[model samples]
Target chain A: MQPVIEVKDLCKTYQDGLKALDCITLDVHRGEILALLGPNGAGKTTLISIICGIVSPTSGSVTVDGRDIITDYRFTRQMIGLVPQELTLGTFDLVRNTVCFSRGLFGKRSNPAYVDDLLRDLSLLNKKDQEVRTLSGGMKRRVLIAKALAHEPRVLFLDEPTAGVDVELRKDMWDIVRRLRESGVTIILTTHYIEEAEEIADRVGVINRGRLLLVEEKHMLMRKLGKKRLTVQLKEPIARIPESLSSYDLDLAADGSEIILTYDIRSSRTRITALLQDIKNAGMTLKDLNTSQSSLEEIFVSLVKEEA
Target chain B: MNLEAVKVIYRFEMLRTWNTLMQSVASPVISTSLYFIVFGAAIGSRIQEIDGVSYGAFIVPGLIMLSLLTQSISNASFGIFFPRFTGTIYEVLSAPVSPFEIVLGYVGAAATKSLIIGLIILATAGLFVPLRVEHPLWMMVFLLLTCISFSLFGFIIGIWATNFEKLQLIPLLIITPLVFLGGSFYSISMLPPAWQTVTLFNPVVYLISGFRWSFYGISDVGVGVSVMMIVLFLSACLALVWWMFRTGYRLKQ
Candidate 1:
């Protein structure tokens, strides 16, 4: 499928000569959720701002659904909905008016019914007449989402949508995002929460400093880089891992209560059966055994660390 | 041109004015009325006429112009500045609307508010002094041109201002003094020749003189020069605003 948004060789240099983005290129597919995972000051927001046309890039070009963002700004902007990281809303305006006005800003005709449905979906229908400033922080974030979707954009960019939000609101936002994706809207969200990316992202891109380190299917990435740890609980405390088990990448607990064996999942033979035999031969009695796979968080950290 | 976008922004801004009706409309009207009472009723009683026009009537145009200029700048500057302060300007900047349309909506609404206040003051002035519009057409022309030009100037100040203090800076230190020195009360011709020449350099003089000429058919400067001066200032303001949007000065990161 043709990408809904294409960013090519994008670079940004601030007035003080701090390079915010360096030759970064990316493509966002239609109707897919792509989570950009980055640390603070990792240029995620800068990239989003450039694509949304809030900040101009130093060099390189971006095209949304085949339209240049700069040359065809009006049409290109109409195709995008950006829920900024900041909670920026007109405090005095009614919830309904704010959303409808956003639609009008995109040159869309007034659609009261559509706006009503949007507010209802976000659980803001009851407060439609209330002033935005009266709403809670979470509700204000929902209003931001409602306004962004007011124009029925084809691509939605959520910049740290769950930041500072309570768990309940985060769950609600996840549900809303799922619904938007079901409606065929392409989503690109920036987040520092690895769990969030692991939970919802179809594809995850890890960026650090000013460069995108890697982008891969979430499951594929996990399977390729994921390591499984075989943890064994000894019947009694041991002073250390016996020399016989030293061939395996083994770690001994400081208290000598357990042993951890690490191995890649993709290896043709995990040699778990052999390792088990070796442990038995070493005269160690395992009271319990369990295995845990590495999470996306670890993969992200290692990727950033490798670059650093 | 995205007329719908312009209308949305314009309506939003006008609605804000209505929400602050006491500040936006009532305050200016009441304040200008005080000027009518002090300068018109009390002061006029002492000085019967100036250049054959009643003292009360003579100051009417100047008073209206003063309020119009100050109110126009305040309204437009505050209109844009509030959005910047609250970071809500991102919504407008990210929208499909063009810069020209954004300016039209904001400046248009600001000018409309000032015009409403100007008209209210004019009506209130009628209660104190018998007013005449010898060139009714010219009076309207001056009123509208003044509102638009000053509103545009306010827009520039809005973009240039980085803080609240800066927002009120130009309107207070620069504009208020200019209007006062522009013969909002007395004619420049009454001043010494050198002082009159210096007063001629003040742009506000042209605005007030031309507006007063429309009312009583008398002016410190020729009506043609006043019109030309206003047009020239309007063009300069428009050019500056155009450059601001093109360069994304303060509007874009």
Candidate 2:
């Protein structure tokens, strides 16, 4: 399928010689939630800013729905909605007025019914007439989302949407994002929260030091790079691994009461049966056994560490 | 041309004025009325008229010009600067609106506010002293041109200002001083030839002189020179604003 947004060989270098993005290329498909996972200052905001036309790229190009962002900026921009990291709302404007203003600024004719529906979706209908300053932080965030969607944009960019939000609100925001996707709006979000990507993102892209390390399907990435560890608790304490079980590369617990073995889940041969038979022949009975897979957080940390 | 975008921005800015009616309209009127009482009534009672017009009536155009210049600058500057200051400018920059559309909305609203205040001050001057505008059409022309040109200048200042201090700097330290020295209270002819020549260099002189001529049918300088000066200043401000938007100076990085 043709991507909704295409960033080709994009590079942005500031005047002070700081390279914010370096030869980065990405494609966002229609109606998919693509989470850009990165640490602070990893250029996630810069990438979004470039695509949204808020910041100019020093070299390379970006297009939205086959229109170049620079040459056909009007069409491209009209199709996009950006929720910046900051609250960025006028303090005195009414919630409903602010959203309507956004729609109007995009050259959309005023539609009170549509705006009211958008407010209701964000749970801001009650605060529609209230000044923005009167709303709580979460409500303010919802206001931002409502404003972004007021123009009925096809693609939405949320930069650190859940930053500083409480867990309950974060969950609510996730539900909102999912609903937006269901409405056929492509969503691209940048976040450092690993679980945020793990929970909602269909595909995840890991970025570090202005470079895109990799982009893969969330579960596929997990299953590919994920390692499973098998923990075996012996009935009796063992001082060390037996000579026969040494080939299995077993690690003894600190108290010598448990044996642990880590293997790649992708590998065809885990050698679990052989290890179990060897343990039985060695006269060691197993009290209990359990296994756990690596989480996205651990994989993210390791990837970032490798780049560093 | 995105006229809708322009209208949206214009309406948004005008709504801000409506929300702050006291500061936008009432404050300027009250202060200009005070000026009429102090300079036109109390002080002019002792001083004779410089031209055929009354000292009280003669100062009307000058006072309006003074408020117009300053208010136009402040309104436009703050209109654009607040967005940048509060980070709300991203909506504008990311919108499908062009630079020209953005300027039209902001400068248009700012000029309208200044024009309203100018007319109010004019009516107030009539109550204080008999007022006569010999060429009412010319008076409106000068008033409108001054508002738009100065509002454009103010828009440039808004984009150039980095902090609140800088935002107020030009209006306070530069434009305000120029309006005073530009014959807002006294005609330039009252000064010696050398001082008069120096005063002509102050751009506010042309604005006030042109506007005052429309009232009394007399001017220290030729009416043509004053009109030409205004057009030249307007064009220069337009060029500078165009360049600023094109280069994204202090706006986009």
Candidate 3:
């Protein structure tokens, strides 16, 4: 099956000689949630802006649902819905008209029912008649989502959808995104919170300094790069790691109340048994032990740092 | 270009404009009425006809043009500027609506507003000045031309402004002073010959002069010159606005 969205050799250099994007190319499969993770100024918003047709590409092209964004802008734009990072709305506009008119702007025939259903889904039914300026921040963000979904586009781009939102509202928004995916809408979202991507995205793409770093499946990435840490509560406090055991690169913590051993999960020769034997030989016993695999947040930080 | 899109956007834009109808239409009508009350009744009582027309009658055209110019510019400028300042413009640009649709929705609404307010001011001027129209159809043609011209100008200003403060720069500094100094409150013939020569440089004087000609069949400046100046200004503003949309100047990013 063809990817729902294809970006090839995309590049953008602003008039003032700022390189916001390099030769970035990637395929976003249909009906999957893909998270674009990058540091600030990592070209996340720039990429979305270009695809949305607000910013012209300095080079390359994008195809949405097999339609060229530039040559077939009307058709291509009809399939894309973008929630900009800016929480901007017509303040004096009513909830109903905002969404309905947005649908009409796409040349779609009036579908009051679709708009009504969308408003209900976004929890905006109550505020449909109210002025937008009077709505809460969370409500405003939801309205943005509603406006994007008004035309029932197949692809939705959420540019940092959860930024500057309260925790409860963030969860609510996450649920709405989940429902949208269940309806077969391909979602491309950018996020500063690694855990958001980890929780919802089927795949992850990391970008830094206008360069594509890596793209991989969420679970596979974790399994391939994740390191395990064994926090062993020592039976007795040891002042320091023994001279012979220093080869393991262990950390003796807080008067030896615990010891930390970090090693790759993929390594078959983790000296766990040997370390236990050595601990016994050194006249120490474990009080307790627990293992933890690396998190996506850690991997993201390390990847960004490595790129830098 | 799509009529459906235009109607949708126009209705949305019209709704926004009506929210401030008092500023755009009603307030101008009321203030222009006072101008008739004070200028036509009190001032005209002493001053005779300037050109075979009562002092009250002479100021009617200028007063109508005054409301038309100010309201048209404010309507179009604020219509575009508010969207930019509030960042709703991004949503519009991101939508499938063509730039033409955005332009029409805004400029059309402002032109409609200008027409309404211009007519209202004319009607109110009648309650005091006992105004008479020799060519009612010509009045409409001239009024619409002025509306389109100034609306285009304000549309360009809106696209050029970066902030709320920037939006005020042109209307307050440039448009208002031009209208006031353009013989909107008086005839250029009353000024000294040197002052008339200086006022010739003010483009707005020509608009008022031409519009007044459409009403009374006489004007201090030649009607041909006023019509030519108006056509030139309108064409220039239209070109700039189209260029703004084509290049996606400040609107796109």
Q: What is the TM-score, restricted to chain A, for candidate 1?
A: 0.95
TM-score of chain B of each: 0.99, 0.98, 0.94
Per-residue lDDT of B1-253 in model 1, one digit per residue for the tens? 7888999989999999999999888998889889888988897889868989999999999999999999999999989989999999988988988889999999999999999999999998899889999999999999999999999999999989999999989989999999999999998988999999899889999999999999999998889999999999999999999999999999886
lDDT by residue for model 3 (B54-90), tens:
8888888988888888888888888888878887777
Give the C-alpha lDDT of model 1. Answer: 0.93
Best candidate (score: DockQ): 2
TM-scores of the candidates in the order shown: 0.98, 0.97, 0.94
What tens digits encode model 3's per-residue C-alpha lDDT throughout A74-179?
8888899999898888887899989888888877889888988899999899899998899998999999999899889999999999999988888998899999
Order the candidates by TM-score, highest first.
1, 2, 3
Worst 10 residues of 1 chain A by lDDT: A245-254
> What DockQ does every candidate get?
0.85, 0.88, 0.63
Global lDDT scores for all candidate models = 0.93, 0.93, 0.87
Off by over 4 Å in 1: A254-257, A266-273
Q: Compared with the real two-chain complex, what DockQ does model 1 have?
A: 0.85
Score candidate 3 by lDDT: 0.87
- Which stretch of 10 consecutive residues in model 3 chain B shows the poorest summed lDDT? B16-25
Ranking by DockQ: 2, 1, 3
